[model samples]
Target: MNHAVEPIELARDCEAIAIPGGETVTLPKGTAAFLTQSLGGS
Candidate 1:
């Protein structure tokens, strides 16, 4: 699989799952993130 390397910033708080535990968590606003992957239909 090929992963993206784009950089991005959150404009608002986002909800995402935590790895390892798969727990639901809120990602606070202004969080910096990297574009990791885009699956078949995602």
Candidate 2:
């Protein structure tokens, strides 16, 4: 059997911004995030 992995695309470019005395999180433009688990059957 063949499995497929889907990725989530970013809508726009994310800029690196400083949080309220917290660490900054940066995600580049057109970032793709894949699903870690399979939802069809567990």
Candidate 3:
């Protein structure tokens, strides 16, 4: 399955975890993130 990779800019500090694998990632405020996929239409 091919998924779209998108570049997302973070507005504030947020915490995220990797799916399929349990990995914690901390995103600081005013940062960017490369999102591969989302859940619940997120």
Which candidate tops TM-score?
1
- Order of candidates by lDDT, top first? 1, 3, 2
Instruction: Give a tens-digit lDDT track for model 2, residues 1-42.
Output: 344377777777665545456667777768985434335763
Clashes of 1: 0
**Ten-residue stretch with the least lDDT total in model 3:** 33-42
Give the best candidate by lDDT.
1
Query: Model 3: per-residue lDDT, tens digit, 1-42?
Result: 334477678888888886769699888987867756445643
lDDT of 3: 0.73
lDDT (tens digit, per residue) of candidate 1 on 1-42: 465577689899988887779999998888987655546972
Candidate 3 error regions (>4 Å): 1-6, 18-21, 38-42
Clashes of each: 0, 0, 0
Q: What is the alpha-carbon lDDT of model 2 when measured against the actual structure?
A: 0.60
Task: Order the candidates by TM-score, highest first.
Answer: 1, 3, 2
Error of 3 at 37 (Å): 1.4
- lDDT for residue 13 in candidate 3, whole number 0-100: 83
lDDT of 1 at 25: 95
Local distance difference test, candidate 1: 0.77
Q: What are the lDDT figures for the candidates, one per model?
A: 0.77, 0.60, 0.73
